[model samples]
Target: MDDDVERAARKVRDVEQAVSEHVTRGGPVTGRASSPDGAVTVVATPGGPPQSVEVSAAALRMGPHGLAAEIMRIADRAQRNANTRLHQTLERVVDPRELTAMGIERGTDDDESGWRR
Candidate 1:
């Protein structure tokens, strides 16, 4: 029993190490989305940050509040997309269940409460 526990711990550690290394070597994961009017565009990366945002000249016509709302909406969608892609990519490197066991959320875009870390 003790040997089994030790082996399991070792395996978990190995998996964690591999995941870290793979992430370190992998390219940044990003997702992009634009407003319905094509006035706002956002490129977002996993962990909830916009890598870049682009606004068209037409966006200025929407007024300050309207443009800000559009940008926020687009950025949210882009972040969700990036998270989905990140989860999918991680699935290629590790079992989905393993990822969950390691505290990585594997929720879909529709799952608003998912993706906690």
Candidate 2:
């Protein structure tokens, strides 16, 4: 019994350490997207917010309306990519079975229902 307790405690500590490291290091939970013409590229964080956007000279030639549309499309793709990355990161830190045992639903990061109870 004591051994089991110690093991569980150790596991908890390990998880805490991993989480701390991930936060401190800003884990690789980012998404990237590029326009079909390779004229615009976007990088976003886990919550689908853009961190950086790069527009090529060729893309700028599209004028305001066309450029704006391309930017929006690329940003959307970037957000989706970020969501996928966040989900994968969660999977790495926590076992799905453990989440189920705790009565937490494991859902894709993109699904609002999945992340919630």
Candidate 3:
């Protein structure tokens, strides 16, 4: 083979090797979130089993309704945290502007300036 073709083939092999190594060695990304009262905390990952939930004894003393609310809040917070991390990870791998230019707006706020949605 010509020098150019040989170099191209080597590059392709290197990329394949890199991808294999990455896939074999990487662990799922995870994030932890805690409630304002610190009574509840949850952990989650994008592509693997979720982390075990933890509730404080003080959280249990809050009564059933309040405890339920706390659980829901914790889940929300955990999912939000996981989503944020996943977005950051994917952003490194993909282009956000591509999604925007494709007219795919996700939880976008109308405020011109940046505002949390």
| lDDT for residue 65 in candidate 1, whole number 0-100 | 99
**Candidate 1: global Cα-lDDT?**
0.75
TM-score of each: 0.65, 0.60, 0.55
| lDDT winner | 1
Residues forming the 10-long window of minimal summed lDDT in candidate 1: 108-117
1 or 3, greater by TM-score: 1
List the candidate numbers ranked by lDDT, top first.
1, 2, 3
Per-residue lDDT over 21-107 for candidate 1, one digit per residue giving the tens place of the 0 to 100 score: 777777667777777667998888777679889999989999999989999988887777776767777887788886566554544
Worst 10 residues of 2 by lDDT: 108-117
Candidate 2, superposed: residue stretches over 4 Å from native: 1-18, 22-26, 94-117
The TM-score between candidate 3 and the true structure equals 0.55
**Which ranges in model 3 have alpha carbons more than 4 Å from their true place?**
1-26, 47-49, 97-117
* Candidate with maximal TM-score: 1
Q: Candidate 2's residue-wise lDDT over 1-117, tens digit each?
A: 999999999999998788667756765566777876789988877564688889999888999999999999888777666665555556668786664454433334542221110
* Every candidate's lDDT: 0.75, 0.69, 0.58
lDDT of 3 at 40: 83
